[model samples]
Target: MEKVRATRYVLPLREGGSMPGLVEADDDGMYVVKFRGAGQGLKVLVAEVVVGLLGRTIGVDVPDLVEIELPPAIARYEADEEVQDLLDASLGSNLGLDFLPGAFGYDGSRVPDAATAQAIVWLDAFTANVDRTWHNPNLLWWHDRLVAIDHGAALYFHHSWPSRAPSPERFAAQRFDASTHVLADVAGTTAVAARHEELAALLTPEVIRGVVEAAPEEWLETTADLPDADAVREAYVACLGARLAAPAAWLPGADR
Candidate 1:
């Protein structure tokens, strides 16, 4: 991903807990910036990039991601104490998704077709994303198509790394309940099952490695268990690979 310097802190999108902000970059593009110093920390950002890349790999529409450099001055100009605090903490590089102009939130009325819905469900299930529901779809209707967003909630297994070593097997065996998924009715188990292999094939080891490596090194938090960024990347690759190899464990409604 290309790196762009944030020229201005436009405004905060306060819908979610993290409170991602809108900002203008040196590239003359506006982006919804996810701060590295948010309450969720860097792990959420990692999930966003990884799952986002996976989504794009299998033909799901996602916003273009970029690394946005946040200079301290941007935070200084913010008047709101809360916004200023967040900006002050997020003083370095952060993640940015290209802002889609005139986009509206998904309201279930504008559902994607069976194929697209299947791909989305498959992607969500594969990544163990639970945020896409009636309440918070995290999806956008842009250019008359459904664009996936807010993957920070996916890949929940990583949050445990501070307590224990990265466990690929556990994540692999994790079952995903799609009953409440936003697209469950539209995609159905059959549609998702049928597209499993096709989508999985697109996430080859090389492809997975590329996605994992795409995450900014600073955001790949290092712990005593995972001492370095490369090790953390490997852990992600292993977890994703294990899950892909054992579809019966997580793929909802797959014949075991």
Candidate 2:
């Protein structure tokens, strides 16, 4: 991922639990910055980078991710107490997604075709992302294309680290219920199953390793069990590898 220093904090996007901010960077580009100090912590940022990279690898349109350096001065000038507090806590590097101008939230009026929907379903299932439902699509229709966003809710298994040893095998066998998925109606089981191999092939072990490595070292939290950043990265690689090697357990409607 590219590194860019945040020049300004434009505004707070008060949508979900963790309020990401819209900011301008030194590269003269605007980004939706996800703070490291947010309630969810560094694991969420790691998920954003890993799943975002995985989505892009499998032909899902996702915004470019960059590491943004946030200096202390940027926080001092904030007028809002809440925003200022967030900035003060997140005084270093944070994850930033290239902001798309004039992008509209996805509505069911312009549904994607079966193939596209299937790919999205497959991606969500593979990652165990439970956030993409009617309540929160986490998709944007920009430039006449469907762009996947906000994958921090995926990879829920990581939240248990330090307390419990990493369990790749358990994650591999986990099941995903697609009934509430935003694209469930359009994403038929047969289509997703048919395209499984093709989509899964894109996420080779080498590619998965690269995606895991893309995460900022500071964001990789060291736990009691996983005592180092490299160990955390290896845990992610192991979980993703295990899931890819055994998709039947998690693939939506695989038995059908």
Candidate 3:
């Protein structure tokens, strides 16, 4: 992943709870940044990188992600107390995505091609991301292409972290309810199931380990069970690998 410095806090996107901001970076690029200091904490940022990268590897349309350095000076001039506090807390590293200029939210009117829809649905099922529902589709229609965003809600198993020992077995068997998925209609369950072999081949252990390692070291919280960032990364890789190995348990309509 590329690293850039955040030059200015362009604006705060209040639509979601995390309050990811539209930031201007030293590279003169506009990015949507998900801060480390957000209420949900660093785990969400980890999920964003892992799931996003995994999606990218599997031919899914995901925005380019980068590690953005947020200097304290930008927070010093902020007028809003809440946003300023967020910036102050998130003083060092943050997650930023290449901003899509005029991307519109996904609705049924502009559904993607059948293959693309199947790929998205399969990816969501594997990651256990329930946020891609009809009510709040995290997909974007940019330049008439389907762009997936906001995977913070995907890896819910990580939130247990220090409190609960990382459970690859549990996550591996966690069933994903995709009946309400945004692309459920367009992506037939049987069709998606047929893609299991090809899609599964794309996510090798080496590939998964790299995605988990993509997260910043500081973002990975140390627990009694997971003493280091590398350990945490290994835990994620294991969980995802186990899930990939056991598709019938979690892959939606796998039995079909």
Question: What is the model-wide C-alpha lDDT for candidate 3?
Answer: 0.92
Question: lDDT of all the models against the reference?
Answer: 0.93, 0.92, 0.92
lDDT tens string, model 2, 1-256?
9999999999999996898999999999999999998999999999999999999898898999999999988876789999999998998999999999998998898998787799888999999999999899999999988999999999999999958999999999999998899999998876787888899999989999999999999998888889999999999999999999987898877763
RMSD of 3: 0.9
Regions of candidate 3 where Cα sits further than 4 Å from its true position = none
User: How do the predictions measure up, each by TM-score?
Assistant: 0.98, 0.98, 0.98
Candidate 1 per-residue C-alpha lDDT over 5-60 given as tens digits, one digit per residue, 9 for 90 to 100 = 99999999998799999999999999999998899899999999999999999999
Candidate 1, backbone clash total: 0
Candidate 2, residue 38: Cα displacement in angstroms equals 0.7
Poorest lDDT segment (10 consecutive residues) of candidate 1: 190-199
Most lDDT-accurate candidate? 1
Off by over 4 Å in 2: none
Give the Å shift of residue 172 in candidate 2.
0.4
